[model samples]
Target: MHDDHDHHHHDHHGHDHHHDNRYSDMQARVRALETVLSEKGLIDPGAIDAIVEAYETKIGPRNGAHVVAKAWTDPDFADWLKRDATAAIASLGYTGRQGEHMRALFNTPETHNLVVCTLCSCYPWSVLGLPPVWYKAPAYRSRAVIDPRGVLAEFGVTLPEEKKIRVWDSTAELRYLVIPERPEGTEGLAEEELAGLVSRDAMIGSAIAGAAS
Candidate 1:
């Protein structure tokens, strides 16, 4: 009886170990994808570091802020962004390696947009800067698509039941940019001033761009 019980316990532990191995395998696959993309010139190693440094020290989310502000204030520019995000964003001199292919997702009173890379961390570094650490985690990669509403809630974004949530998946060939809804009570603000109200999280669809305090 003792030996049988011990064998049962060992099998249970082995099952848990197998589950952990699967998680590690997923991470390994993600790294392998990154390597393959890098070899194919889809991902630039320096570009990642540059983006991280920019966000940590200089430039930062200001690049995206400007884009968002321009879109909010200039209807023509907004149309251009919707039509050809890459060219429109490049027109403002925000072009880079991973940002070669871009699509702008506009949030409205009835719809919200969220972005995630289920396979790997494919992000538009030029405009949004380096993706947050959580964006690359397996939990986020899976949950963002499976339970986006719950994920948004964790980020302190509570959407009304009437509002629809749209989750976009990023890939090596393309990436998404969430154009947050403009805040209220700032109708007379200048473009630069409007830019100040935009935040990185807001652009990520994890938070809303509230009225600038």
Candidate 2:
């Protein structure tokens, strides 16, 4: 089933406005710092933009999507991923810093998985690239565990009432990657095509894989 939707009118009752404001302030400070550094010839604005662009386009969710697609097509790899996610993922050439230790949370018809770092923003940067600002917010960290269903609702993901919501806490030592359920009508699709259906949020459990069209 297609479980994801655009949250055009989601309620923000669960959000901590204070945290949002702080995040905004932090971003502004960062931009100001970047400007000062560039003016002083201490940093190259073009290089900074290039690095950010690489992460956003080349090294981001596409890496995770490839892994998910491979798992969907190869049972042996899927088994290996279930057995040792870190090694299985590394076998695909996706390995490094924040992703040194990894775990794969496979979503199923009866259950959905959501990942969060309660203590801090411990994320799998190797595959998923930089984490989203919301993922690092204090509100998200605290609420994802206390009220996962409500949190998912905020992301426009509404699971069946009978389906269980499982929340995984990521740590500096180990991080998680959600493997969303493969959408229906995709049996004939190739792996590359399948990868296109998986979104960054889907792998994080805030959204579902796109339904085949």
Kindly give the number of clashing pairs for every candidate: 0, 0
lDDT of 2 by residue, 1-213 (tens): 122222343357866344422335666677789779879999976787776777767788899999999999999999999999999999998885553699999999999999999988988887899899999999999999999999988888888999999999988999899999999999999999999999999999999999421
TM-score of 1: 0.73
Best model per lDDT = 2
TM-score leader: 2
lDDT of 1 by residue, 1-213 (tens): 011112223474455453222335666676789789989999877787776576677655789999999999999999999999999999998886743599999999999999999989998787887888998999999999999999998888889989999999988888888899999898999999998898888887888886321
Error (Å) of candidate 2 at residue 71 is 0.5
TM-score of 2: 0.74
Give candidate 1 regions above 4 Å deviation.
Answer: 1-59, 211-213
Clashes of 2: 0
lDDT of model number 1:
0.84
lDDT of 2: 0.87
Clashing residue pairs in candidate 2 (N, C-alpha, C atoms within 3 angstroms): none
